[model samples]
Target: MVEQLSLLAGEREVDDTAADIADPCEESGTSVSPMLPPAPLNGLSPSLERKRLQAYLALLVGDVAILLAAFYTVSILYFGTLSNWAMLEGGMISAYVILPLYLTVALYNGTYSRRSLTEWQTSAFRAATALVIAAALVNLLAFFAKSNAEFSRMVFALGLASTAVLMTAMRIAVSRALIRKWGPTSLNKMVLLAGGPKLNLPHALHVNASEHGLEPALDDPRALDRLSKYLRNMDEVIVSCRSEDRAAWAQVLKGSGIHGEVTHQLPHEIGAIGVVHYDAAGVSALKVSSGQLGIRARVAKRLFDATVSGLVLLIAAPLMLAVALLIKLEDGGPVFFVQKRVGRGNRFFAILKFRSMRESDDNGAQSTSLEDDRVTRIGRFIRRTSIDELPQLINVLKGDMSLVGPRPHALGSKAGSKLFWEVDRNYWQRHGLRPGITGLAQVRGHRGATDTETQLSNRLLADLEYMQRWSLWQDIAILAATLRVITHERAF
Candidate 1:
């Protein structure tokens, strides 16, 4: 049955029928063979990712052809040199100069990308902008090199103007032609549905789990291998299973190395957790969370954190040095205190802060009281102004924390009479992201101490909300808001 599945990867394009997947899972099930051997589907088209790359390359080549054709044709019309050696040399030099600049700008502006192929209007504008910028750059480079005199100014101007016009026209024509060829999307994705009830989806391939001896048991490597085989080259693999089976299928999808979804039951079956249709997939699904931040978002966030932290440290070095002197003079103790706190992925890290409390043999997780004698004279002043927290900028630089995220907590930290996590099971979920120096909760005056359940709940709620609606802009807003709440009433 598993061998039969891989054989179907190259079969037909997007043929969907029924999806009446079968049977509850059990460990060590009997192997079931396919009734008929799958056809040897050897003539498979390229994967969607490859197809997009190929399309982008083709568009790039087309742009080059168009530019050459337009420029040389314009040169012939302008200089009446269909075969002139002077025109040939000039064209070659111009091509060498303009082609690299134009292609670089076009790639940056998304002129030869999927968006260009999909939405021709944006592509047209982007293509025109790239050409204009490239032309300006070439002229600028020539000016600096003192070589502008060698080129024909009128012919150059005419060629650039004509090429820009031709490029835009060609892109529009190509995009429209693409739409007719591949419907709405650039690539008609082939989707395979695993173990679903009857669906009105005729554009997908359906499989019966039990009949094919497929199970969503993680421990069953054979079953997982079979499912993986079935999903090879599939753009999307949707698992429609009973409620008890959904979790297993979701795990399978995570390891399947393909975009996947698990179907949700009707509203009546799930209760309270409302079931609604997703127009994009034309089905109701749980849309399992793969990640909170995508690659671009993560990169932007890391850059922001590093840049801000580095600058802040540089600007605050003198102030920090003075604080360190005060800290050392206070009791002749360590200038910085390192506490074990839970960070991203529930891992423990040493958080750095200006020593704000007297050195003692007690557990470091103990929260200080308003008038705790353990806080030294200098510690009191620094804690009140939140200056003790400045050293955490080092943590941000070290990549153990972000500029704005849920603040990390000590392992023994408590809310009222109970441990922080004990107050709410979701307390651990906030650790999915790196901890921060200041966060939405801190900006909103939820800092200092978690003295009550409501206080902890509010912070947890804010952290979760921040995660759900996270963005670099939001982090910036949180940082801006932090300034106003730096010296809060509960700081000490």
Candidate 2:
């Protein structure tokens, strides 16, 4: 497993065959037109998805019911009689708290996932873990809230233990029953072949790579959309391509929202993140990208963005209001500027900024110079002070952007004589992350005008580097470093 594939794989390959394989983790450094976001492809098979949803819903109901029954039963038994309503209600408060907590934890831990339908042991284990965590949290809350005295310790222990045992047993039984009803492998997938060996993937769609538009060109959107159409209703894609083409297919599959695997023969040559052996098929395949960010990382990043943006907005509200008034007073134009910028996944999003340039036909056709005539008196100060970017905090809050990542450019923005994308094909790959208000490029003094290709290329490299090494700590560090440059000479 190459855990550091994203960072280390960018170095030059030792041979020509290896040269064809561009590291999916790094920029390919080639030029092509920007790729379009693929149309929605999944959920094409309503039956499988509908069944999964129904199964999840049923599990949710079953969990709530079991929790209610176990707690009430334990309460009645502890009281020695059902008629003593007041005493029986002792466990109800803790039970109410425990229910929501358990459900929340279970949802995140894959307790209600499609895997739970076939893997009884895993379902039971996750359910038990969620239950234990929920109980611990309730105990902590009770301690902090000074409500521990209201509930009996013995009942809490008995109720939690009994519930855990019941949930585990119930999951095991339900999972087995579901497996019996659904097939052993309830997944939909597509299989591609290599010349030497034949694969016996009976339940999967056998696809021709060329026919389905699987090209080595990330620059082509039509090909990607066609490939996405073929992958619709599929959970996984296992392809047998030459080692050189693996990286390209990996990127395509990653963008398609499908789990991708490339069958490997020369393991030593490929820098795979991990290798999955299909013992039944007698072949090993490389695991493709786990995604630009995992679900947990995404959730954490989102929470961080919301918290920081919300607080910053609160502190800067008065200042924003003052800027708005000044912009309006200056030219009676709109205080805020909204422009459609290419965002994550190559989707268009309206980025908010305080108007810095004069109201003209400017559509990012040119870079803002240090002393452009288009700048109004208030605009120049705000631009130079980086105050013009404050409104993007709203973009972060609205989930259209991030606090740290690649800074999105205008569609018409260029590097020297060419457009940004034309300057480097890797330009589109930077959109793998949400555009940021402050990024590695900005912190490294790569801001302001991009009068030459080298400037955009350098910034692009930093953007790619940031994505490769992305983490909460790094984001915090980049954000802290950003404070040093808010008034830098390059802010223009």
Candidate 3:
């Protein structure tokens, strides 16, 4: 049956018509082979399993110790001594109540999972979030227990802050120690691949698998016993076969008692943003999103843009006025340059900037060089300092741009002789969000003239990455980084 399934899978790869493949079970008089044997019960002995349990226990103990230390330190600092009557009472209550609650929350959030342990950043974020939630819950518990009087608000705040810092430090220290002892490559969980020999896996799959500590083993479908032995240590099984053989592989993996997934080779350029499964009429279908933010996120982003941009413009009004006067005095041209630039939804809007160039009829597509004769003396200083971009705050306030997004491109903009859209098919996708005064690409030193295809591609990738991973915190971080980016040698 395994051989028959493999043959049909191979034929399905070549033949486009699904009706051409025949089921071996239907053709024969015999019933389909019974499900593959269950996986071995004793893959690891009792002693080895005990050691794994001990490691987890040790981690829990270390966390408790760290929390205790944080509470004591905060109590001592705030009350001048741990012996303070109030401090001692608060410490005891926290030890008996808050710490256990925090630990429970962390566990529920999967902060201590093997995957989380290996990826310290993800674990740290989860820990922080859990701690925050736990703090809120603990406060409510104190109120309900009528024990709020026993704790000092100052001490509670200090403890929470110190605990977050100390816990993060502990996680980092332990992760580093683990990496050193196991060697980074040794820490990855194992994965098993099942499919015919002809399956073509992409090079990136192997690279990413190794990086994520997924040690992959390719198994022969005929050797069920050997495959079951391999499954004992595997964290997951990925079936990489044609659709026709999916059922057989599913059965084999199901009885193996391991989590499984099905996938096929994908083009290098296509990235998986997210996956959604839904029913279309009576048929089920899977959809892959290509980095589009939902409506709620869009609304939140606009609100954030409006609030931040308004505050910035209010504070910088005087500076903007001074710059406008200088620009007009330098060349007596328009105080602001209003040029049509492509924005979100592939629409055009007039992008505002303090006029920094001499009056000219030059086409906007013409690339500006550092030594361009059109730049006024004042223009050099403002452009170098990035003050010329300040007027775009108006555009943000007008809902024509965002404070942090892909920078809008001028119409007819080209990388060398080719238009930007012609340089890459995905170029226009950058317009999925409103263009910004500053963006991920700009902060990464991709701010200069994109005169080559490679430069444009690099900027496009950065834009796509930012869009795919957008968060309010990320935007604020990028805005802060913009200060440093403006002084970069390439900013001019």
RMSD of each: 12.9, 10.2, 20.3
Model 3 Cα lDDT, one tens digit per residue, 70-133: 7777777766775576656665566557787878898788776655554667767888888788
Question: lDDT tens string, model 2, 348-438?
Answer: 5678889977854335877777767888999889988889999999999998899998998876788898888778756666766788998
Provide the global lDDT of candidate 1 against the true structure.
0.68
| Greater-TM-score candidate between 1 and 3 | 1
Ranking by lDDT: 2, 1, 3
Write down the lDDT of every candidate, Cα atoms only: 0.68, 0.72, 0.61
What does candidate 1's lDDT look like per residue over 34-123, in tens digits?
A: 442221121122345555666778788988997887777776787777668776567556666788899999887778666678677888
For candidate 1, which ten residues in a row score worst on lDDT? 18-27
Q: Assess candidate 3 and give its lDDT.
A: 0.61
lDDT of 2 at 26: 26
* Top of the candidates by TM-score: 2
Ranked by TM-score, top first: 2, 1, 3
Which regions of candidate 3 fall more than 4 Å away from where they truly are? 1-291, 360-363
The ten-residue window of minimal lDDT in model 2 covers: 1-10
lDDT of model 3 at position 17: 32
